[model samples]
Target: MASCTNWAAHKLVHAWLLAALLVTLLTLSPSLSAPACGVLATVEHPVEAGRPLRLLVVGDWGRKGRYNQSRVAQQMGKVAEAMNNIDFVVSTGDNFLDDGLASVDDRAFHESFVDVYTAESLRKQWYLVLGNHDYRGDVLAQIDPALRSIDSRFFCMRSFVVKAGTVDFFFVDTTPFQLKYWTDPGEDHYDWREVAPREAYIEHLLETRRYNYLDTLGIRLNSGSATELTWKVAVGHHTMRSVSAHGDTQELLQLLLPVLKDNGVDLYINGHDHCLEHISSRDSPIQYLTSGAGSKAWRGIFQPNEDKLEFFYDGQGFMSLEVDAGLAHAVFYDIDGQALHNRSLSKSNRQHVDQAPSLVSQE
Candidate 1:
């Protein structure tokens, strides 16, 4: 009888200890508990004068809070907090999932964007562009100000320019450049309701008159001369160069590369390959960066373009950038908030030599 009583007491003590541990863990910061939102990672860097722009770039993240989306958001929150003064977030399209939001009031909007990225640091303005997936749904709703009424952080347009300090960011609408979307949508349903009859849109984009001679001036030159344009960055949803399964975008290369080259653009940031990558061209000053690993990732889909490819990772993550007057610093972090790659470039290092460039080569 005494042995039975002692065993019962021991079991009770064990249960109490287990419960205490659980409570302690739950009480800690959400990030410390596990991969979750609302947790802030502590990072401190002294702000240098003349290099005031700081931004976070993410893409293809809308998965309705699943597929590591929440975890990635959590890490972004932490990074944002640590790296203070993040001016804004660049959404490289595919902001919505599979088919995109059905309407301005679509449930997916809240489920994927609002509820998923509920971190204090993520409250900044979100400059967004449409992805090919976004075309599969109501594309107008995304660019409408109605979304801003829902959450003031949302900002979307077909193409526009934003000037922050000495730098000029050119946001380009790239989904229309793909000929396949026009010729063969296949099993996918693309809601071309707003800008249907693909040929017209492409013609207008390519036409110097309809495009306001913008194409002739070159998108990069729009930023002005070196004295005025310290940094020129081009952001788009499609990639002109990549080594992933999607490979290189032929349309973008033909239409966009010349403009980038002519204008002496510093970096071309895109998110279509669904991974993180950096490709440095020996022939041009422009560096290619891919930050499509917002949530879903293509495991082992790398094709390894060894000539220009610098860094490539097939996983879920995002990229952070800090631009100063003389230097541009880039870092890629995984879902766990771990830094994967870091590279910096001096303003004097900007190359503009003309040569037929190869795509991202494998390491």
Candidate 2:
């Protein structure tokens, strides 16, 4: 009996050792065993204890507060207050419909945004990017800080970074990256008032050292920030990969995806296809989230790819995210505030982490 007990103890020790080794290997291997993509630049936003970060994401929603936009906003308020603290809101772009804002004083601003999202909880800062529809109007007017003076909530920039707590949100101007918009308009009308001569925009992205500089900065910031590395997220108006009506944005896949992949980004959020979707690629663990169902939805207009698609809802709705040090939770809410789907990710289970022993518990 004594000999048998000793043998069992030895077997258990070996089993634990093997499990540890497997965990180490998994942590080192990039998701799908792919190479890392970009150099991460960190933005410093300290998260306070007991105060988790929360965000409301919407897109393609500017329509003079008509349709489902008002209903979505109302639900957002209820969700925000329930979450206790919502840091801010994120507009995945297409902020205006049909045509972009004509001027800083464009009444569409009030009608579409100001008047629609009247919930006191939603009065916080709104980080915005430009979409194709927005580029159809005056691009310069949308980013003008003067709009903030009129209403403190409107915050739009071509490309900027917002760091809160241990997360860095990189907002990129994806509309200008697509060449077809400039080379071929066909029947569509584009204002090009401030975004004219297209070459300048393209050159800035390809030739200039702007993005490269950010890459270096991200590396340093991520290394030195707080105790653990901060999570990185890239926000654009278009998607790198999707199974929606728009399919995939080729330009973004080629130019931007590598950067996001290399920087170990956790999520890429966008809104061009007018639907809510979640996609996960085996080649990389970066999640592609779409929340463009603010005002209108494409109903069943989607081409489903089982390999890439995780969840998809064909209706008008919005998305909410709550982030903490150990986990990130996401949920989709319909226009009537009904919870449809929810997903959660633990930090230890992240594909980019160095070790993931706790992932076993998550399973």
Candidate 3:
């Protein structure tokens, strides 16, 4: 009996050691390691044949339907219905206010997103990037694959690419570029799980010339045999150029801006400021568009910047982009479903032709 008991104990010890070794090997394996910054996940969104691609962009609004979040969503739904056959929605982060999701099962996710944008027309896939506010909480929870089970529309990632016909939208993770979030976080806690060693991460993401991970995206623009013009749009949570409360994210301007410009990115859409704005870059053809007026917005918080402020509105609103083979139209609508500003850009001329804000007759 004593010998049998000792044998059982030895077997148990051996099993424990084997399990520990397996876990360590799995953790150390490069295949099981965290995704490299250069490897941006790509998702293909099919655009209807012979139809223009339409998408709504909203940001900085996860306040549980408060601060006109519901209102904006309602307006979005109305606009989406009117447009008909909308492709998808692009959320510029700040999906949750104060902090991000506590976990994948956090009720706030359903309350702020699922319940708010309940329009049948607004039930398309939502591609999202991470904002500074989103990094304060459980960052992994926001991008967890499990959230899709709760709501299929919930799609968030640190950085990814959305390919739709002639357009390729490069959604970049800009929160890690900000130095203050690391050195002087004040009272806020940032979840930098996969983004430690900031220099290596950013370098891999924006590497040009040698590896040319992101820059090569432009090459594919003219690769096909069709005569359709290809468009490149860069989306992020921080502003590379702005004339609002968070006037300009210096870190992004210094690091990300050059890469975008070099890569022939036509538009840089972001939403850090709590307002809707459009600024044309002085040096490049890239247009800076902000549609952050999803929830609370600053009343009179405007600052001077070098770029041309094409339009600025300090009220709650959302923006829409309609793109076809040759032209792209962008419009900003106020809370009451009125068009505050609209612009049309042609692929041939690439000129910014501003149109007067026309009112959308209410239903």
Report the Cα lDDT for candidate 2.
Answer: 0.71
Model 1 TM: 0.79
- Model 3 clash count equals 0
Point to the candidate with the largest lDDT: 3
Give me the candidate number with maximum TM-score.
3
Per-residue lDDT tens digits for candidate 2, residues 1-363, read 234335334323222112222223332212112112223322233456686688899999999977788988888888887777688899999999978899998999999988899998898778888898988887667876677777877867665557788677877777867888878978877755534555644554467433332443355335554345466678889877777788788887787777777767888999988888888867877888899999988556777653478788888898888777777777888887877767776655674333222111111
Give, for candidate 2, the lowest lDDT window spanning 10 residues. Answer: 354-363
Over 1-363, each residue of candidate 3 has an lDDT whose tens digit, in order, gives: 234335334323222112222223322313222322223445677898898889999999999999999999998999998887689999998999989989988899989999999999999989898899999999878877677788888777666667788788888777878989988999999987755655554454455232233443344333352243778888999988877888899987876687778766788999989899999999888899998889999668888799999999988999999888777889999888888888888777667765634323445
Give the Å shift of residue 253 in candidate 3. Answer: 1.1
Candidate 2 ranges with C-alpha deviation above 4 Å: 1-48, 191-227, 305-307, 351-363
Tens-place lDDT per residue, model 1, 33-83, is 221111111112233455468889999999998889999999998888777
Clashes of each: 12, 10, 0
Better model by lDDT: candidate 1 vs candidate 3? 3
lDDT of 1 at 125: 77
